[model samples]
Target: MTAPAELDAAGITDPALRAAYTTCRELNARHGRTYFLATRLLPRERRPAVHALYGFARYADEIVDDLGDGRPVVEKAARLDALALELDRALDGALDRAVPGGAMGHPVLAALADTARRYDIDTRYFRDFLVSMRMDTTVTDYATFEDLAVYVHGSAAVIGLQMLPVLGTTVPRADAEPAAAALGEAFQITNFLRDVGEDLDRGRVYLPAAELAAFGVDRQLLTWCRRTRRPDPRVRRALAHLVAHTRAIYRRAAPGVGMLEPASRACVSCAFALYRGILDEIEAADHHVLHRRVTVPARRRAAVALPCLARAIVARTRG
Candidate 1:
């Protein structure tokens, strides 16, 4: 729980606003472990904005996905709707001339509004993201890759788009958008491949249903795999196919690392390597994602991060 140095660097000096940014930073560190690690590699000045984005997303996700017993789906949907409206108000409040940053009552949204204003990020991305969060309430599985792409675009791709400003791309946004989108999709698809069991427990399956059927997998088979903790060859095959597909997306996203501002490059490269590493770990385990979560070992993360650490230091020193 170190104080967020980035908040000060970003000119967020008001005591209440700084506290709001701190709350967002805590959310990122607590729930977004991998994402938090990535933020650590960024220029300290830029980290608060990334934390704000992650916090906003995590808050909405919890509302939709972490409801306890006796909470009906309708209630969760209504809560999600409330959140979307709150976000709308928060964004509008940012434009107010009288209030400083027009921060809303919700600390996370207040921090998010400040970041959005600072970066001149489009509000449409937030609206699209809320749409996907709302989708999680009812959409359990996708019928095709095309259908799934639409949801993932809102859920994950816009996140990368939202981050482009904070990351400080060297190229025009138009040139960089495709790569950012591919990277986002790659990360989410990797999560889907690794979290198949946990997602099933939540009564959701992110894998395209058609892809599953192509490998003779269905909901029941996935449940059996989860219960048995034994690898089914067909399941393994399907997972492998997805792993390869995700790798292709990673490849598509790789060049964007070089396209980021030099000060930001090391951080994003670190993240790209680390997330892509999850795909490798999944393969090494022979695609046995149904039984347990696959993760890059801490030692391995340290190894991958070492060079980026040096690059980040150089970038900071140059500044």
Candidate 2:
């Protein structure tokens, strides 16, 4: 509903492309409530690029998760493959290329293509992300954290890697990559904690079997608890362990916030606090993530946001 600030900062002038980027921003605002909130702390020109990135990820995710019901697994795999091919073409400088049969006038792809070129973001990151989405269609559970890292590399880590360019880091990418990756994985693990029940409904388990076993928890027990709405002490213990692990990762990721360009610092800092707030919410709710999604309250969001908003305004005014 808000006007996308596209004229000066993003260098987008074409009416069609501006509209495409606006559509992506709308998607980011609609579905990724926390993400969109953090994005608001970015300088206005920078917001659209972040939104385009989210749009690209969200489009592929919807194909894998939302459209999966009643469809054959083979059909879903084919769709993913088709999308990968289309993405490949777009990244290779051919936006108008049709997806095999017909023209695919997807605005997300259009905006993503523009953003990728603008920021010189690597195509490999996009490739890895699509690979993970493809894996989600078939892989239901992980045996070990090490085994799951293979999936997380693509789904989570590369996302931060992709975003680093847009965020404009102060140091070489190699110097910041570790912190970026740690932060990304931390956010993803937090999601796993909050969405255990929902993932079970989709016939998936994100928690590593080995780690769950360490806490005396298992998939069958988790499924039973979800069905019965009974909270097990062991399950609570397992979630607490996960929360602690994610907190450590957030610590590892924290130093990288200072590595970003001054104007981008507040945005990433706000995101860091807001996402870490979910873990705090889980603790406050007594780790009852199995029953409902835990969230940072609007008042808490505003509280975190107010300081970052002030910092961002100062950064922009000085620029």
| Cα lDDT listed for each candidate | 0.87, 0.85
Report each candidate's C-alpha RMSD, comma-separated, in the order given. Answer: 1.5, 3.0
Stretches of candidate 1 off by over 4 Å are: 68-70
Clashes of 1: 0
Off by over 4 Å in 2: 94-104
Candidate 2 TM-score over all chains jointly: 0.94
Model 2 per-residue lDDT tens digits across residues 133-236: 99998999999999999899899999899899999988998899999988889889888988889999888999999989998999899999888888899999
Model 1 agreement with the true structure over 128-174: per-residue lDDT tens digits? 99899888888999999999998999899999899999898888988
Evaluated with TM-score, which candidate comes out highest?
Answer: 1
Candidates in order, TM-scores: namely 0.97, 0.94
